[model samples]
Target: MRDAVGRRTFLKRSAMGSAASLTPTGLLAVGAGQAQKPAAPSERVRVGLIGVGVRGRDHHLRFLGANPRVEIAAICDVDRSRADFAGQLALRGSKRRPLIFGDFRSLLDRKDIDAVVIATPDHWHSIIAIQAMEAGKDVYCEKPLTLFIAEGRRMVNVARQYGTVIQVGSQQRSDWHFRRAVALVRRQRIGRLKRIVTHLGNPGTTSGAFINPGVWEPVQTPPEGLDFNMWLGPAPYHEYSPNRCHFEFRYNLDHSGGRITDWGAHHNDIAQWALDMDASGPVRIEGKGGFNKAGPYDYANYLEVHYTYGNGIELVCENEHGNGVRFEGSDGWINVTRLRLDASSPEILTEPVSGQDIRAYDEKNKSEEIPGTDEHHNNWLDCIKSRQRCAADIETGHRSATVCHLGNIAMRLGRKLEWDPDKEQFVGDAGANILKDKPFRAPWRL
Candidate 1:
């Protein structure tokens, strides 16, 4: 059985490799060869902005301001105010401002736009991404890549089918310090990796029970100039509750995967990258948690999940210490987060990347801390022009998101699950298998 499984994996990868060689997007080549020449700054790439809320605004400003090569050609948001605000921002220094629309499809219809940046809520990610790629635009969608495992697979398929360059928004993958940590582990500089612990901080509490009355009541009217229905998109119908929308959407299951996917997307991505598990994930997962009854949320507030890989590596995900990652190996252990990198052997942080040991994507062949700016958004823009895969490509994003979903599913089911990464199924666990995908409301199909 082991031999047969190995043969199957080999065949699948071989077929994928062959197909990738003929792809026009040129993703696989970057993975296989040395970094390509830098893209010319004078050659501009036109972009369309989708979902211009908080993240959308950030992308709009960075791409339009920082990247001289990018021009914001269109902006779309269900909220009229947001769309108008984005248009104003895009027109600040330009003679011709980008066209604005309340519907994303209208923006996609334009022929001048070359790519799209999707910064919408979690539930809207897959659908928007699928549509954009189908419309012949490269995509940079925020993570976790999909709301569920099945949607992620579909997104991957659609990107491949369109031969589009799709970069997932796991920004830590672009961080120089974080990439250094992964390099150290892969080089065995940390010795043989034994285990990994990812700390996700405390799962925030929802509204208190006593506050439920006020929280449950909808505002008298939808905010001025906002299209509530379009914002809701394919998510199940619900009254306009601020807590259930916008940034607060993270707490709900209908539109978000809770903190599991929120912080999990970032930490789990680094965990998977260091473990060299970009194409695959744990064979088994188990989790335990408690939920809050006083809130509209249906997901866990606190949880600890254990994932065991086929190669004997163990990854622990817990809502305990503040957000960070720790890698334990035979020689020592290293802990890294947005702020710091510390290890039993501090030398690991300073170790140089030798000629044979440098990562393929390390264009300058610079050491750990010396790579390009740690700004993930800028890195994606740089890669788009260079025709190189961004630090967090679709495959990397999918695997990390899969890990996050697996943890959530395990905690929700209160049972252990055996996963097949290639088949993307739960073996002999019918109950858990059901959580792999959720039913999309009518008119929305992956």
Candidate 2:
């Protein structure tokens, strides 16, 4: 299970003098994950845009369009209107007319494209990114990385095999505040790390449902201008529902793990980053919550999960815990979110970071804008040029997503489960093991 890079779980003593344990799952094995250098393109890197919905149009297109060195080579979406809108937006500031396609494969077929921006729903992230990388294109994929834990593992293997540059869209890793917080934790400024509290918002309701009705809604015909089957790629086929497609899809378990993976992908990721657990995850998870038993939305609603890491650190994921990561050590604690950072003592944030202090992944020229001017996206573009690792690399994304998946599994199963992080499997639960991967609809396989 050792990867292309020589990364392995290392035993580190907590301030309390306890050593962390890791499973032999081979996930810690890290090696050179970079793809062999592609033939260098000209000054501007050519990119293919996939899933031109809200995030695709707003964040990716706007940022790539703003960058002088990036050309939107192609745009693809199941929805024709969204694709056309993104194509027109991508055409701005570039001499080359961007190609518009209804399918992502057509965009991947173009040798002119060097990389891809994947803003599709959670279910589509793994497949499209893997296909794009296999086609010799680097990828910038949105967060959570996969629809299931197995998909995330497969994604890591494929990326390593292709030597492609893949960055997960967890922008907090590139934030100055997050970096500083991680550095301080590594420096033991907060004494020894003990526990982390993460706040992810509540699971949302399903489309066109009032409560848990326990009855399947009648399937509806596909909407005009949208390819319903294509949109459900790799997922179990069901009658089309407007709520199952767009932004509301996150609340549906068929496509996503709801807020557990949605916002958990963000906040729990920070907990992993600060605790140096990006390459590993929890050894025990126990959760309980309310499910949408009466509504069309089946994802968990009110959920709370407690995770215990190999090193005896506890991570609590809950609703209303406040939206951020709070690291509690022996001396004090520091909490950080998108809004701002608050610490038990001001000195934690004020202390000067030393050269030897643990630092977050770095951009060669921090001052120069990367592709999106948004630090996380920019890191990926810069890595494409330098063949370096992005802030939220594939491994990091997989590990973090696993935490969320494990929480969902624990809650859904209504049990306290023992996990072997190294083995990446349940200790003894046969039923839990069955959930690592899911059955996709016919004609779609990973």
Q: Give the TM-score of candidate 2.
A: 0.85
- Candidate 1 lDDT over 1-446, as tens digits, reads 21233322443454456444322222122221122222233345678888888877865554444454567788888888888987888887665678888888888888778789898899999988998989978788988898899888888887777656677888777665566677777788779999998888742221111111114555556798878877888888887877777776777888877777988999899889887788899999999966677666666777789999999999998875666788999999988776666888878877665434435234343332332333455455545544455667787898999999999999888888899998999999888888898887777776
- Error at 52, model 2, angstroms: 1.0
Indicate which candidate wins on lDDT: 2
RMSD of candidate 2 to the true fold? Answer: 9.2
lDDT of 2: 0.76
What tens-digit string does per-residue lDDT give for candidate 2 at 32-102?
22222332225456888898888889988987776655678899999998898888777776667899999
TM of each candidate vs. truth = 0.85, 0.85
How many backbone clashes are present in model 1?
0
**lDDT (Cα atoms) of all candidates against the true structure:** 0.74, 0.76
